[model samples]
Structures are given as C-alpha cells and as structure tokens.
Target: MFRGLGPEIEHRGEIVVIGLGRFGSSLSRTLVDMGHEVMGVDLDSANVQAHAGVLTHVAEADTTNEQVLRQLGVAEATTVAVCIGADIEASVLTAVALSDLGVPNIWAKAMTEPHGRILSRVGAHNVVFPEAEMGQRVAHLITGGVLEYVALDEDFVLAEMTAPASLVGVPLGESNLRRDHRVTIVCHKPDSGRFTHTDRDTVLSPQDLIVIAGRRKDVDSFGPSRR
Candidate 1:
C-alpha cells in the first residue's frame, strides 16, 4: 500500500530511481551523496554496470513491467523518480507500473508539456522539466551580475550577488531598499565568514555577499549597476 503520500517529499528515505541515463544517473549519485539508500534500475546493462559501485543497489530490469519493478523492491519504496529520457513510451509505462504498484511520492522527468501532462495524469506526484529550468537559470546568470540565481516560481526569484557600492557602509534599516527596490536582503556573508541571517541593523561591506529575494524583474534590477 502507498504510504506517506505527503505534500512534500522528504530528502532522507529509501528511493527507487528508474532509468540510469544521464539524468537518472546524476540523480542517483546525488541521492547517495546525501546519505539516502537508493535502488537504481535501468534496462541498459552498461548503465547498471557503470553505477554498480556507487548506488546501494543497482539492477538491469524492465521497469515498465509491474512485476519487475516490484521484484526490484520499488513497490515498497517511499519515493521513486521516473527519469527515463527520450523514450517517452517507456517513461510513461514505468510511471504507470509504479502507480499500479501503489508506491507513494512518484517524481518524473518530462521533456515536453504534453509528456508532462500524461505523466501527471498517470500518477506522477511531481513532473519536472530539467532542461527548460536549467536554460532559464543560465539565461538569468548571463544577463545579471548575480553570482547565483534560483527561480522559486515563475515570478519570484532569489539571487546572490556582491553588495553594490550604494549599499556598502549603510545599515539595511537606513537604506530604502525594500521601498525603493522592492527586494529584501535575506542574508549576507563577508569575505571570510559564513552566511548569516540579515536584519535591519545589518550593515554591508564592499565585498559582502548578499542573497536577495523579490520579483524577477526587481531582483535583476537590484544588481551592482543599480543606484
């Protein structure tokens, strides 16, 4: 039976990853690095061999078959990600199998909107477009002076950038950043220190790193060139 079908997927749990292609492989590796137990399944023997030493358990199996997935212990998994690439048919089928097995917290990768819709309908709790998201992230980094950019949603973003000249030497409370720029500095880190929560009294140094959260346009405009 499906269990713990919560709104959010916990990072620490037993996860079954189908497909050992680039996306699947990378995901499995990261999960293992995070100290999670991972069972990686792939149809390709080469892929299975490549990750045999890394994953807690890896097998070459036809994940499109419900019995095969169940035999691989996918049915009992708390979380599973269908990361099959290119072969949309296989991806959908694998997702269907996972759903039939009643595994909770199914995550899937979709290459297109239609494919994503199908995955969602077939019981994928979350469908992600990795390529499209990455392209958007890279575009933001190339355009703005931000050292890092994360789009929390379509409109809101969190950006990390160096403290501009205008912000240096001024306590955040005295600056009209929120009213004028419509962005809030979440935290700041000095050249030699770790990041810490920011407050109204927090003053910025010329080399301090600041993470700001706001609307995308506002965050992009709050860069070093902004006055």
Candidate 2:
C-alpha cells in the first residue's frame, strides 16, 4: 500500500472506516487509490451510498454500536480509522468499541490536546488531529523543499520530496545529509509511496520520495542532498 503498510497488506482481509465526514471520505479515497479493498460505514445511508463505488462495502450504522460494527466485519480488518470530526464523543466511542472488538489497530480523531490525552488513555492505538497537523504541513510545504512535513515529535519531523536532481548518484553514509540538510534519511521510496526502494544505492530517479527528519525549521529548509 502507499503508506508502507507493507507487502502483506495486499492480503487485506477487510477494512471498515467509520464516519463519512470529509476526513473519513478522503482517507477512504486514498486507501482505495492505494489499491486496497475498503468498507466505509456511517450512520447516514445517503453518505454510505455516495461512496459505494469507492469502497468495497458501504454500511450505514452507528459504529459505536458494538453489534453494528461486528456485523460490518470490523474485527477482521487489519486497521480501522475513526474519522468523526467535532463530535469527539462519537470518535472516542467508536475507537473504544473497535478496540473491544479485538480489531488489530484502532485509530481515533482528536480536536485538542485534552482530547488526545483522553483518547490515548482509552486504549486507542493512535489519535489524529488531522486539520491542525495538515495546516502545519501545508504551511511548511508553501515555504518549499519540505512540502509535506509531518512531525514525529517536538523536535523531529518527517519530510517528503522528489529526489533533488543534484543528489542523483549518492548513497546514504557518504551523503552527509544530516550535516547539510539537518535531517536523517529515514527511508527511500520510488515513485511516490507506491513501493519501498531498499536500493538507495541505485542512482535516484526523478520523483523518488526521500523520507527524512530533523528540527522543524531545519527539516523545512532541508532539501535533497546537494551533489
């Protein structure tokens, strides 16, 4: 899958995405684009019908209801994303319900620091504040180089790129990227996130994605290693 869910992800048994809001809708789109079979569940039949073509299955039900989720085959899903926005209650409830169902991974949405803290306390695998994080990402992208930076911590950020034409034929250890770009080369991806390219030794072809990290501004200014 595009996000490096790994090669085994193609064996996707099933996937249930709860809530048909903008966030959930977009995520389902991206997952489908990644060539995975996804099921979108929501309380609104109209919303569920809207994504019927995009997802393998569309179920209109309250995901927070354990029985409804079970009927939707959520327990078999390797991952479930709860994208209820504003209604943190629904989001938290859905995450908790999914966890109880033995879903391998449960992702919840949070609107604030307190919400994140609470969601983390509830046993959710992860809490996402997408809008805020995306704003920061777009802001950094507009600044250039680190167009889609995602912070991993207070001090570390993950960035993306089309391998800088300058650093075409270089390998990691010899690149000294940390000293020059103030970022660490985490992984290399060829042609977007379509596949992991372990052969960093292969001269970088155009549009290879370099996943890197460093301090906020430093990572933002960091470009592909200069030849």
Candidate 3:
C-alpha cells in the first residue's frame, strides 16, 4: 500500500518535486512531457488530487519532515525541487531537510532576494524567482518593438522583432547594421516559414521575424518601434 498515487519507489532517474501548486505542478508536468519521471509531493490534498493523473507519482506529505521524505525515497533521488510558495519557513525547512538527506541537486523557488539567499545558504544548489523573472521579462516586451525577449545575462539579450522597411531588399552585409547598431542578426523567419540561420548575405523582407542578439540597449534600439 502506498501513501501516494504511484508506486512507493520509482526508478533512479526520477526527479522529486516537492509542492503541487501552480509552479510545482507546471514544472513537474513539463518534466513529464520531456520524458522524465517526476514524483510530486504536496501538503494539500486538492493539489495532490489535481496532478494525480499527470505526474509519475503524487504524494501528500510534509517534505520538511526528513523521515517522511526518506520514506518516500527522496534521499535516493538525484534532483529535488522545492516549489513551496508563500510559506518561507516551510520552504527553508524543506530545503534544509533535502540538504541533510544529501540529495545531489536541489533547486528551490524563492519569493524575494532575501529568500533566495537564505535558500542558497541552506543548501539549495539553485534558487529561482519565477514570478520576479517573468515580471521583468514582460516589462521588456510591453515597452514595444520586441516580439520576444530573453535575457542571456544582466546586460545581454536575444530578441525577436519584425523587419523594418529600410532593411528589406538590402543584403545584411550592405546595411551597416552591425557597425551602426551594434547587434547581430542571428536568424530570420518568414511569416509563413520556419526560422533559419542568417549570414551577412541574408536579405530581409518586410515584416520577416528577425532574431538579434547583443547588449540589451543595442538590441532594444535596433528593434522597430511599435506602429
């Protein structure tokens, strides 16, 4: 008899995801889609029931209790993620328990910078602020021009934007874009076709989606302004 929805112990490669709330469930589902086995845990029965059919395993357990986690075979997992949101104390305690259990890889979500630092100090190998990161990313896109934006680093970004009229028909080598704009066009996609790599000889067509990479300011300036 198992306390969860699946077998008591899964194969070695499975990931232990603690918390079945929005973030945890979304992550676990994605992992499952990617061909990874995910064992999901949550204190809320509703949350557990919601993901019972999606995850490889679903359990209602207090991950802060090392014994319970051990009983669930979490100690043998190579990776564990603590997606406990709102409750800082429970998140920290769960992280501490995971560390004490010697889980090799620990990823934890934090609501704030201070919370992230605390999680890192308590042995979470990676601390992520999903809400904060998404907010910042949306802020960039809402300013206009860019259709998609990904920050590769604090000052670097890769962005997608529609081709400007001035660049259409002209080969990229003759456009002086890199010299004048300080950004590099990495790829382009026709409105009806898939994206392909770009080179200096590539000619832009009006409204083609171009992916460019450079320092944040440079790429932002090169993007066409919202019409």
Candidate 4:
C-alpha cells in the first residue's frame, strides 16, 4: 500500500499504530508478520505490554500530545494509523497532531459517519468504520441465500450466494442475469471443488455458489428469497 513511498526511505523505518485495540493490534501484528517494522502505542500500559513481544516496538503514551509523538519520532514513520474509535476527541486530536507533524500517510478509525467526516476534515488521509462494515457483511450473510457479501463501495458489492431454486439446472447463458438483474457472474464454486471460471454454457446446480458483482440493490435482488 505504501509502494508509492519509493525505495529512498530506509527499509527499517516503521509504521506507527496508535490505540492498541483489536483493530490496531491486529493491523500491527499483520504488518510485523509481513516483515515490516511496526511500533504499537496506546495510553493504556497494559495494552502496550500485551504486545511487547509481538510488535517491533511498544510504547505507552498519550498520542494526542504532539510532544510525546515527536519524541517517539511518529512523523518519521512510513504511515500512522489512529485506531482510537471509541474516543472521538482523542482520535481527532491525534490525527491533527500527525498532520501538523507532516506525517505523509494517516489512517483513522471512526465510530460513526459524523466521526468519519470530522477525522477527514482534521487531516486523516483515510477513515475506516470497521464495526459498520462488519455489520453490513453479517447482515448479508444472514439474509438467507447470500453466503458472503463484500462492499466494493457505497453502491457496489461483490456477493457469493447459493444458486436459487429457479436457477438450478439452467445454463448460465440463458439466465439473462445481466439483462434482468444487472449483475455479472464472476465465477462458480461447487460444494466439493475449487472455484472455476464461469461461462455462458456453465450450468448452475442447487448446491453451487455463484459469485456476482453489481450495484448493491441489484445483487440483493438477484438471489432467492431469504429464509
């Protein structure tokens, strides 16, 4: 993701993550596993100590303090992610401090739409709502036919769903999905086998999972009735 940073930057330069909650901790650990230097920070001493051995560096500090951030060299990191979703004040203050310190990349977690807007206004390069996104995914999964759903954006989605009874044994070419539902089948996975590229001639079975992409509304309407 930081490929645009170029090779001039030292390889050992770290990615600093503040607020060692579930999202922050998981992101730090994943970056470490991917062989990148990571520094995890939190106001809670226990959170910092919990990840001491797992992360490259662990620090306990109030990230909203510009002095503390500067002392920790937060501005020198390749990127900084502010993960204090529950505390809007801290999240916004931390982002502002990072921006003032000239951190090139700043990501933040927001608890609500208004919070996200505030974070962006305060110089967060990216704002993510993990809880809201997960809620949408789980809602789709529980909607009967949908096996999985991924939101590509606010309006578009990629979904995998069971072949509806109406579509069972029908050749893909005759389904008229593109014309009627405004969706395109990307692939199909049988219950017992790997996914295969789908073509017009491919026939869907009741047990098969069809991966489709289109507008969120269209994709939702393409599948069978929910249980």
User: Could you give candidate 2's per-residue lDDT for residues 38-78 as a string of tens digits?
Assistant: 88988888889899877888888888788888877787788
Candidates' C-alpha lDDT: 0.86, 0.73, 0.85, 0.84
Kindly provide the TM-score of model 2 when superposed on the true structure, using C-alpha atoms: 0.68
The residue pairs found clashing in candidate 2 are: 141-147
- Candidate 3 weakest lDDT stretch, 10 residues: 1-10
The lDDT of model 3 is 0.85
Alpha-carbon error at 50 in model 3, in Å?
1.0
Where does candidate 3 stray beyond 4 Å?
1-12, 224-227
- lDDT tens readout by residue for model 1, 1-227: 01112378664467888889999999999999988889899899999999998999989999899998877778888889999999999999999988899877899998987898888898888888888778777887787677888877668889888898888998999999999999999999998999999998999998899999999889877774553
lDDT at 54, model 2: 78
* Candidate 1 Cα misplacement greater than 4 A, ranges: 1-6, 9-13, 224-227
Q: State the TM-score for model 1.
A: 0.90
Task: Point out where model 2 deviates above 4 Å.
Answer: 1-12, 144-148, 152-154, 159-181, 184-212, 220-227
Which sequence of candidate numbers ranks them by lDDT, best first?
1, 3, 4, 2
Error of 1 at 202 (Å): 1.1
Better of 1 and 3 by TM-score: 1
Q: In candidate 4, what are the lDDT values of residues 1-227, reduced to their tens digit? A: 01121123333478999999999988899999999889999999999999999998899999999999999989777689899958889999999999899887788888998888888888887778888889989987886677888887778889987777766788889988788889898999987988999998999887888899999888887765422
RMSD of 2: 6.0
Q: Which of 1 and 4 is the better model by lDDT?
A: 1
